[model samples]
Target: MVLAAEESQNEEPGPAAPVTMFGPDFPFPYDDWLRHPAGLGTIPSRWHGTEVAVVGGGIAGMVAAYELLRLGLRPVLYEAEEIGGRMRSVPFAEHPDVLAEMGAMRFPLAATTLFHYIDTVGLRTRHFPNPLDPHTSSTVIDLEGERYRARTPDELPNVFAEVADAWDKTLQEGAALSTMTQAIAHRDVPTIKSIWNQLVPRLDDQSFYGFLAASPAFTSFRHREIFGQIGFGTGGWDTDFPNSVLEILRIVYTEADADQRLIVGGSNQLPRGIWSHEPADSAHWPAGTSLAGLHGGRPRGAVTELRRTPEGIAVTDADGTRRTYPCVVFTGQHRLLLSTVRCDQSLLPRPHWTALERTHYMSSSKLFVLTDRPFWLDTDPETGEQVMGMTLTDRLPRGVYVFDDGPDRPGLMCLSYTWNDDSQKIAALDPEERLEVLLSALEDIYPSVDIRSHVIAGPVVTTWENEPRFMGAFRANLPGHYRYQRRLFTHFMQRDLPAEQRGLFLAGDDISWTGGFAEGAVTTALNAVWGVVRHLGGACHPDNPGPGDRYDELAPLELPEG
Candidate 1:
């Protein structure tokens, strides 16, 4: 699930606290790394004036552009739409004080890389109401006409406890969750590979559904069904059941879905802040220069064509202006390059093109409405409890959230956030219809609460799958696609690319080992930054190892070829 945010009067909590997702041996020190001043590396004096093209304005593209600027290269960014890309924060049409996050709302505390930029920009954040989090005052799980509101795990039914235990046992005995996670925490790259390598070949071809069904821990099909309905971190894994088990493992093993928070105003601030921020130190530009300032207040129009030129790579924008950059980072959706724009066939290797074509992205839709107040806080006559807090159900509206901006501030509510086929069902519906359907679903769940009366404005709905700029919300790899994912994830390494494709690098959440997370996007962006630096004859700092420097040690496991 994407992170969500609301206005907060107080500053965000200090740097993320260490989590015990992988037990005591967990080794990666994200906080320590982020606190370090000397970044990835600096380029040599000879490469001071190189120009690079960042072909997307999302978090990935903006980070890549910022890092390139710091390394002494001039990065010209291109975006067809708004700069934030999927990190969009839409304000209520009637009430500007209220905000509806269209995409990528919730952020996990474990995403250290993403936090680095957030901290750098001094963005305020508050605890997100992820299910079961201590911060979540209440959570209502409705299934089959039954409603259970839990403030603590013990308050939940015994079956829920059994499901959690079963999942833990299965992961421990089957996938070495603790062992690999500990290795990952410590950055014990070799050990991580050793443990993860064994799991890949064994699980690569397996679906997420297969893992749960085959696990002896989940002997009863009912247990599996219950777990699927009320998933541990985010609610309901039914939509993701068909995806690769490796995808699920990455989220669980890395703790990417645990202990989450949201930027106070909006998550989009991270990208937009980075764009307008003047790095304290830079190679060519002065300390006061910003990416937006460099590009004359906004990025060039969307790229229409990309092709190889004698000198470098040429990018033709929607405005028909063409520019050649020595290095180009392709951060836009791969589908956009293949279908929307005219990409030169030779720009990427045939295998990579195949990977791009085969890449699978899950569709997601979110409907948000501005309400006069937090009407859900109203107590029931019989139960004397609030209608709901965060809700999860097997009904039409899978997930529901209530946002409070202070007692008097107008409230924001996400009526529903649906994924995959569920989202597709309402893709063609009008916003009013979508809101009506969601309100009806909510009414059924909370018959006593007059939610409709509190609504101050029309609903803001987004079907990301149908968005032209982004074909889907985020990448979710399918079974038998690890090899393809490997190719895309590793494309940032210049050593692996042919001469013609050397200057063109791929970086996005889609290109990372762990997708559907902001950290994955940041990691790949940093990788692309390193690749851009290398392509322009720059080198990683000996003190600050770049992605390539640690690729062999930290790279994903290589599966046996067919």
Candidate 2:
């Protein structure tokens, strides 16, 4: 599985510098990047020569590359793997099997950056309407036997009723801390050390378990056995194979704040389509940028290296054989920033590869088993929309999927798993044990169906966790990482490098605040590229990247076509 780009190392290594994200906020103000700039499209770039090189082929990188072209700036893209990073689409190799999504499954309209591209591409999609709702929704918080399904306004009568003090702490006076992310995450710590320091002291005296159960917030939760119900939604609540009652409830009672979002068709479409991942060749240019695709790539030994330059800011892939440019935008992972790019790390210094190493991210893997038969799921007949995914007695394999109408795989279905951390062991698990886990999970979710006896399958594996191509699923800040995030988000990536060296810009979901989600990846890439254009004093923006060109071709995906 080692890719060609990672196969041969023709050059010797000599380090250039260390980079970090410690201080100084550049690019877009953290608050504004979350939403589209009120006056976006007003400052369109009208240039042909302003070009950029972007690293990583994920949504952020691709969107940056694509946006560069839209903004009238040229861009070249570099990727270590296939265009789709973690947000990918997977299909079974055989005919009878259903197409499955191993990465992200949903998208929200609130994700402004992604929404822009979806409109641009004219990709058809269904809306989740509201991420959180009282109807068709139920969440149960069970600490041992005391359990219940969240229903009606009475079930979970607003956490605000009991946690008013805690809620007040979130604002400014009570136990609120310097930052909200810091405040909630530190609920376990004495609310004192952090913002919730005062709350911690109060928490110490009361049994939160009883307090929550008896609170009006949990009056209507009806408990159901959880053991067999896990891992049903492709990635239920198990992040790293470990789950908590709270995490499960969060998924069930999911409330997409200014931070959360989703995709309708899928999440991979935006990231992969937006960036240009080929080698940059001047000969094929139209006074703009030219790029070559990652024809092939794979993991080699321990250290994953690309037969490519640090993701260029001026061109996509810096083809050693092609002409060189001074700028590069990196959109891969934290580790890649240090290992792949040859730059000054002192800009955001913490430790020798320590910041990358000490960082803890949430990750998971899934197996999508497409069946030759329609593995039953509740559906709306008139609209054909998927309803309850698994029956009360339904035994789904590992993940979840709604069926497609056509007979081609009409019986087709998809299942996945996520929020896990044991990917390394997967390369070592015994085959039978893996099967047992898959079967048991399904049996529990759908016991009456005897799904194992009814279905025939196996194409189950997602590299979201193992492959070195990506450092890990988009970097999710650990409980404490939020403290340094002020620097992590606002500083480093936007630096004071000389024009020739402004090649470094971040393009992933690591430090984004509201910009930290999938939508965050969308705008973050735009911000970095636009920042580079302005920093270089080059004419780059929507108006000047090149003449306005619309993409007339697509996968033929439109509601009218469907």
Candidate 3:
């Protein structure tokens, strides 16, 4: 488990302010906006029941729809499959109590906006057993056919410490990490913009690997290789090497990878809870009003076509039913606009269409299994160490996370979680085949332990690339894609857009600066909500201004197109 470098030893400090995902780009205080006493803006009395088409019932869509309802608008939600989208949690057939998190499993506390909904929905969270996390009993690092076990970072080999030190030096010298992190923690907009705006044009074209290679501290290829194999915070980051360095900086600078937590039951509960929850302050509706009740217990079918008409944006469902609404929020994967959904060319400007076409998504796969008990805790009599521990390897099973509910409850194990090329390698295999492949790899590391014997329920598997609704797991911008991302992230503030492109707004993790995290989904949802409200001739309370109200002053810095 690779760790971030410690703060400067000489720094004067009481307890520092907690870090939140306030942004290196578009640093708006979304958490404060959400918590404002003046609600999330209001719609005029005349537009109280006006219908707004919100495509996709994922976290972003659900958030947009739920907030829309509170603002007195009727959001007509359309979902292709289920409500939770990528926050999917699958229950074991035989052992119904245990779940296999097929989508997002862990979340960082910096995602405050997401936590707001989680708290509102009455969901609980516990420290996730990340590699080398304090909550984890032990961790095993297996690379190049060599295995080593450690209970903490200090227990690892000297080479591990060397690689960690090199990473620290690289960040401090190349990216000014400490200074920028302090500015972000303090919410100093001027300082953040001054530092990030300078870095954007300079680093936007650099890949994560390129950034590391250029650093003086990482001149050694062996050091770079080790750093990639065991990455900072979560797991191996070699798969993310091809992505833009700015993407990596966004993650680390915000502490998005540190001190992560998992929803008590499953991540799916947040979206599902929002779907069924009836807000006490919901305007223009009865006391018991909820999104579930509003839609008659189920959302409309999948949207097949989207076109713009003089009246409004028209949405056609799979059932051949057509609905036109004055405003529409599209929260699905942007790639769907080009593939699954038949969208009219005139709906958005040609440049925006180009942005959607150029969007890149990362492929991911996970294999999960249920066991009769937390057998991993059993000590090895000879070695005096646990029989098995959370494992990270360079082999097919890139990362293995152990989840022990309790002594009495069934145990869950993410046998394998791989990204990019690693995921593609096993994409063709069946569930049993995937399980066998993972077991075969783990067998080498824990030769004395028979992992297969304790299995209670089957190994469930998912390759996000094969899922038709979601072509890939999530978007990860590559080098030189900054302009494209800028177009999508700022699409919601559409006053400058042509009249034809005004009503249709885009909001999703793909449309946010920090994609693949729930904070991005929720923040972009709030952006879309603000867009919808403003489009329908509504305004936020003076005390609680929306993102759009502060857009001109706080928008992302633009780079040279030439």
Ranking by TM-score: 3, 1, 2
CA-only RMSD, every prediction: 6.3, 15.0, 3.2
The digit string of per-residue lDDT tens for model 3 on 1-562 reads 1123334343553458888899889999999999999988988899998889999999999999999999998999999999999999999999876888899988999998999999999999999888888888989999899888998889999999989999999988888888788878877777778778778888899999999999889999999998899785798889999999999999999999999999988889999999999999988988999999999999999999998988999999999999899998999998999988999999888999999998999999999999889999999999999998999999999899989878888889999999999999999999999999889988998899999998878889999999999989999999999999999999998898888889998999999998899899999999999999999889999999999999988989898787
lDDT against the true structure, each candidate: 0.81, 0.41, 0.91
TM-score of candidate 2 against the unseen true structure: 0.60
> How displaced is residue 8 in candidate 2, in Å?
59
- Write the residue-wise lDDT of candidate 2 on 1-562 in tens digits: 1111121122423343111110111212222332333222322334454555666777777766665554445565556666766677665566422445566555543344466666654566653212123322332222223323333325534441333333223223321223322212222212212222223223323332332343443343331113223322222222322322222222221122322233444556655444333322222234433232222232111212222335432231334434244455566766665655444543334532354554555555656555555545434465353323422222323334444444444443444343443444443454345556666765444345555553465645664545566546656433333333334443323444443334456556664533225655665576575566554554323433311111111001111111
Candidate 2 segments exceeding 4 Å error = 1-47, 96-98, 127-266, 272-323, 340-357, 378-388, 391-416, 421-427, 430-433, 453-456, 492-501, 514-516, 538-562
Candidate 1 lDDT score relative to the true structure: 0.81
Question: Which candidate number has the best TM-score?
Answer: 3
Ranking by lDDT: 3, 1, 2
- Per-prediction TM-score to the true structure, in the order listed: 0.94, 0.60, 0.97
Which candidate wins on lDDT? 3
- How well does candidate 2 score on lDDT at residue 100? 56
Where is model 3 more than 4 Å wrong at Cα? 1-15
